[model samples]
Target: MTGWNADSIPDQHGRIAVVTGANSGLGLVTAAELARHGAHVVLAVRNTAAGAEAARRIGGDVEVRELDLARLDSVHAFATGLVSDHPVVDLLVNNAGVVLLGPRRTSADGFELQFATNMLGHFALTGLLLGALAAAPEARVVSLSSITHKSAHLDFDDLMSERGYRAPSAYGRSKLATTVFGVELDRRLRAARSPVISVLAHPGLTRTNLTPRAWEHRGRLGRVVARLGLLATQPVEQGTLPQLRAATAPGVRGGQFFGPAGLFETRGRVTEARLSREAADPAVGERLWAAAEELTGVSYL
Candidate 1:
C-alpha cells in the first residue's frame, strides 16, 4: 500500500475525538490535525492550563479537560464526564505516556506509575467509554506502543519493578503490554462482532519533551542519547502519522499496527508495520489481558 499523509485523512465533520496528553508533542499534533479535519477534539490532559493553551493554539473546536492517568479516579471522572456530554466518540487516542524516569514510583492507586499511566489507565478509560465509542457507526481506539517493546518481557512477579528499577526496561514492558492489549482486544472484538476497532501505532524516535524528560531523570548518558535523538529524530507532526493512519485509514483493520516506514522502521512515511514475536504471542497476550483486568478493574469483554 502507498504511504499515508495528512491529506489522505478523510473529512471528519461531526466526529468527536478524545486524545490524552493533547497538550504537546505528537499528541498535540494529532489533536490539531483531527481538528483541522473538522472533528470536535477533546484534550484530556493532567494540566488544565497547558491543555487550554494547546487548545487555543490549535484554533479549533477543541475542549480542554483534566485527566490524570496516574490516578484511577481521575481517569474515571474524565471518561464519565465526556460520555455524559458527548453522545458518541468516533476516535479515542491513548497517547499520553511517560518514559524512563529515575525511580520506581507508584500511582495514586498504588500501581506502578509507568504501567498505570501507559497501559492500565488507558485500559480503564477505554472500558469506561466503550459504550460511547460503540454508539458511533465506526469508532477507533489507537494505543501508542514503541519499537523498544520488542526487547521487553512481561515479568509478572516484578511488574512494579520492586526487584529493581531499570527505567527503560520498565517503560518497554509497559508499552509491550499496551501493544499486546490492543491485539487481544481486536481478537475479542472480532469474535463478539463489535463495532469498535482497536489498533496500535508507534512513533519511531521522535523529538519530543518525553525524551528530555527521560534524560533529565536519568543522567549524563541519557542527556547524550537525548541530544542524539534530537539530531536524528523525525518531527512530531511526522511522528503522529502512524496513529492518525490507524485511526482514520479506511482500509485499516482491527489488529493492524502502524509505524514509520523508513530504514530500520525509524523515520519515514506511515505504513503498516509488523509486531515483534513477543508482542504477537497469544498466550502471553491472554495472561496480560487477565492481569490488566485484575489490576485496573476494567473489562470490555
Candidate 2:
C-alpha cells in the first residue's frame, strides 16, 4: 500500500486487456502502462482515428476497437466482437467517463447521458464479457469510480435525472451508481464461485480532458472552472497510478478500491481508499443491481 506506482506492476506477458475510452486521459495511461508491462491491450474507444493515433503513441502490442458507451447497441456489438475475437480476457478497465456536463442530455438509448456513459454501459459490457473474464487464469473487472460519489446519493425513482438535472449532481449520481455496481459485482461473483474479481478505483483530481470537455457547454463558466481545475489537478502520469495499482498489483482482492494517498485523496501515490457508507450498503447494491439489469436488459451473476 505504501510507495506503490506503475513500476510495481507485475510482468503481464501474454495477458489480454480491454480498456474503455483508451484514447486519452486516465484510460490512455491505463492502457499504455498495461501494454508496457507486456499485456496485449485493446484500446476500446469511440473514435477509431483517435484510437489509432493513441495506439501508435502507445507503441506496443495494441489494437483499436470502436465502442460508444452511451449506446447499448454499440456496447453489445463491441462486447460480442471482443469476446469472440479474444476468448480469454485478463483485464477490463471501465475508465471512460464525462464530468460536469452543464445541461441535460440523453443518450441514443434515452437514458441520461452521464448515467448511461459512466455506469449503465459498463454494467452491460461487464456482464456480456463475463464468460471471457471467467475463463482467464485470473481476471479483474476494474470499475472507475470517483471522489464525487461520496457526496452523492441514488434515488431509484429519479435514477436518470429525468425530472430535473444539475451538472455536478447528475455526474455524482452516475459515479455512485458505478461504485455500487463494482461492489455488488464482487459479492455476486463470490457467491457464484467465479474466478473473475471486481475491483474499483478513482483518479482523484487528475488533470484530464474530461473536465474541460464536460464544461464546454457552459462557455465562460466552463473556461473559469477549467482553469481552476488545472490548478488543483495532479499530473496525468500520477493521476493514473491508482487504477494501475488496482489493475496489476498482487494480492488485490474483489471489491477493493484504490485511490490517491494524499490529503482529501486529491493527489499522491496509490493506496486503499474507503468506500462511502452509502456505497458499501448491501441494500443499496441490491436495488441498484436490479435497476441496472432492468434498465440495460443485461443479466449475469
Candidate 3:
C-alpha cells in the first residue's frame, strides 16, 4: 500500500456501495469516486434534497436515500428500505460523524448525540444490513474512526455522558467507541465464518463541513481557528483515500485499519494504522458490544 491514493481503487463494476452523509465533503468524494469506478452508489444522507443535488453532481448510477444516523428509528428505516430494494449490498462505508457541538445534546432516543450518530446508529445499521451484506460474494463494512480514539478513554459507568459533559472528551469517546465496534465486528464475523469483513479507516485532519460546523458557536476566535486549522489539513479529496482504500483496495483484511502516512497520521498517502491498546482489548469490545445491543435493541453475530 505504498503511496496509495483513490486512483488505486480497483474497478467496482457490478458492486453496490452505501456511503452515509454523502451529500458533501469526504463522503461526497467517496461516493463519487466509487460511482466513477462503475459501482452503483447509494448516497445515504439525512436530507433528501441535498442528497439529490449530490447525486446530480455525481451523475452516475447512484441514488439518494434518507438516513439520519442520530436516531435509531431512522437508522432502522434506512436499512430496511435499502435491503428491500437491494438484497445484496457489497460495501457499506459508515462515514457520517458529528464533532463537538460545544454543548451536551441527546438524540430522539435520549442517547448522547455524538455517541448515537457516530457509533450506536452505525452499529445497529450494520446488524440490520447483515443479511444483505452476507449475501454478497465478499462484502466489506468500513467503519470510519478517528485519531481522537487513540487518546480518548471510555467510561462505562457514564457512557452517555450523563453526569457531566465536555465537548472534546465526548467526541473523543464516541470515536473510541466506533473503533472498538469495528474491531469487534471483525472478530465476530470471523468466528461466525461469515463472508463479510469489517475494516476501519480515518481521514486525518481533513477539511470538511463538520469541523467548521462544530466550531461555529465559539465566537470570532472559533471562526479564525477553524479557518487556520483547515488550512493546515489536507483537502477532503486527499482525506478520503484511506477509507476508499479500505473499501476497495485489494488484499485488505478484516480488522485492518487504514490512515494517512504523515506524522501522527495527520496527512499523507494511505497506509496501515495502529490501534490503541484500549481499543484492541477483547474485554472492552465485549462490554461495548453488549451495551450497543441493549441500547439499540439490535442483535446479530
Give the candidate number with the greatest lDDT. 3
For model 3, name the residue pairs that clash. none
- In order, the Cα lDDT scores of the candidates are 0.89, 0.92, 0.94
Compose the digit string of candidate 3's lDDT tens values, residues 179-207: 99999999999999999999999999998
True-vs-predicted CA distance for residue 241, candidate 3, Å: 0.3
Q: Candidate 1: deviation at residue 231, Å?
A: 1.6
Q: Write down the TM-score of every candidate.
A: 0.97, 0.97, 0.98
Candidate 3's C-alpha runs over 4 A off are: none
Ranked by lDDT from best down, the candidates are 3, 2, 1
Judging by TM-score, tell me the better candidate of 1 and 3: 3
Error of 3 at 259 (Å): 0.3
lDDT string for model 1 (1-301, tens) is: 5756988889989999999999999999999999999999999999999998999899878999999999989988998889999979999999999875677889999988898899999989988998999999999999999998888899987777778788778899899989998998888888889999999999897888887766855678877877876888899889899999998888788999999989777899887788989889889888888888888888877
Instruction: Report backbone clashes per prediction.
Output: 0, 0, 0
Angstrom error at residue 216, model 1: 4.1
How many backbone collisions does model 2 have?
0
What's model 3's overall lDDT?
Answer: 0.94
